[model samples]
Target: MLLNPLLSLSRSPSVLQRPSSLLRPLSSSNLPPIQGGSSSPSLYCRSLVQRLDHDAFLTSYFWPAGRKKDAFFALRAFNIELASIQETVSNPAIGRMRLQFWRDAVRDLSNGLPPPLHPIPLLLSQTTTPSTRDLTAYYLNQIIDAREANLLDPPPPTLTSLLTTLSTTSTPLHLLSLSLLTPTPPAYITSSVQHLSLSIGLTNLLRALPFHLSRRRAVGLPLDLCAKERVVMEKVFRIASGKEGGEGGLSQVKGLREVVWEVAVRANDELMTARRELELEGGTGFPVGKEFMPVFLSAIPARSYLQRLEQLDGDAFDPSLQRRHWRVPLDVWLAWRRGRF
Candidate 1:
């Protein structure tokens, strides 16, 4: 999943200044050394998550501190690393080699063997104890397998294909996060988490479009939607490359807004379904446990980003979309206070 650059801690000093012990200074000296060093894996995890996935780092503050929180960071760090493989490696075989390492790592972690000298796996080994079984090899391997499958695979041909990619890549994250908080979350919670995962996954794909285009990777947007909307991929690349710009610049690209609108609408539908699931489970007065709210809080950023995109009339290329919404932290805090996501 692509991270929204808007919620980055580097861009928002006000978010960084929030008074919480969980918010550590994002300086290297304060974080632990990398893998194989004698340092707390939690610190390494926290540092890695903050640097690579700031939104995850920001949402992670909602999780209770200690082992549960640390486990959440470890899981996010693992995901961030895997998500980053496409950008890091030039060759598909090299990416597979890396994925193979993680596959072996997960297998070892589940078998109670000494994990390889990696901070994320080591931290996971310590927190996901056999007694608790909080994190499972099944979920970890699902994520790796999906990432491996995506290595040389072409862009999704349809929306169904896109959701299938998310079902494995994103769904497992929510399940694993919920498991860290409670061994068995209510069925409603599980269902809602699944919906939220897809919602966020779609939103992230939109947010990352600019970044992907810069690298000539037109992967997240489905081929069917592009065909239906007459969205010329070459035109999109020219616009992104600044080769097609003047007055009425982005508008020159045909059917792009329609494609964006379709994607955003799907994201909103998933988000609303998640909310409706919660309401149906307990009516309007459902009791939101503190333990459960952290998982729900992730919805705040996704909802906020989607709302802002809608305000711009689904203009994905709008420069305003790149900046952090000043109210996000306040919105998150207010949602937390009201016992809602």
Candidate 2:
């Protein structure tokens, strides 16, 4: 799978070095405490992910302890903040300003300083070493750039366009996560990560389609597929909002189910491609390495969502689809125990 090129920044090594003389204790003004009065940024990130990104939070357990896990949560927390902007803000200008703040915050991180009182940046600044700092900032900035473009809320014209757009939005975080594990990941590993990230991204779009439709946001579904299926967004919106009898009216669209199936199939295909890359010559399809298991394990929930979609016969608006899968934790634990996604 092809991945988007990451944006690179250049700065002097000395510029990244912190001045020892200026170091001072954090206070309420410089470091606002999280709810419940805890000042720990890692804890804040952990709480944020646990609340808004439960699947990622669960998969985080497989990452080895210490700085790697801290970096993992920080990246996820940053993503959640960006992803939530379009939904939370009343206007695009506000969303753009928030994304710009993150862009500047990323610059501060590269300069070896966390933006004041921001838990995610605080944790990121703490976790990054000189070796990892530049790449981390690059990855964060790439995500910010992609999300800033997405704030315009353009529906992709084709499935190819959708994947192209999502490749930048979703793929970099996986790459950054892998970078945290090893500066030089094997070629196969990087390829597999790209496939998995796209798979997860596609699956997430499917799951969120109804919610997006209800809000009258740009349909996350490709216009080509929607047109091929004769899917009317107005009807989809009516069904999602219960104006036309809710999910029970979904079948009235005729082509919507097929469109959803086609997208879900593409998502599954990406996951399968990743699996094929990891298969041993004459063994079970489990991957060979334990060190990268945490990253690979992310595919579990994505796969599970795709499977659930299949069971629902490609119905994207099923209420049950919005609920967390009760079996995800057990599935993740088993996958981790077996050393594969």
TM-score, per-candidate, Cα-based: 0.87, 0.85
TM-score of 1: 0.87
TM-score of 2: 0.85
Candidate 1 residue lDDT tens string, 1-341: 31443334434432211111111222334233444332667888887776556567667767898889988988887887787786678899999999999988898988899988888888988888896542578888899999898887578999999999999988998888888899888888888889999998898888776556756775479999999999888878887778877465564478888888899999999988888787776544345677788888888878988999999888877766655567676677667778876
Among these predictions, the greatest TM-score belongs to 1
Q: For each candidate, what is the lDDT?
A: 0.76, 0.74
Report the poorest 10 consecutive residues by lDDT, candidate 1: 15-24
Candidate 2, residues 70-139, lDDT tens digits: the string is 8898898888888878767778899999888888888988887746577888888888997787998898
Q: For model 1, what is the C-alpha lDDT against the true structure?
A: 0.76
Model 2 Cα shift for residue 260 (angstroms): 0.5
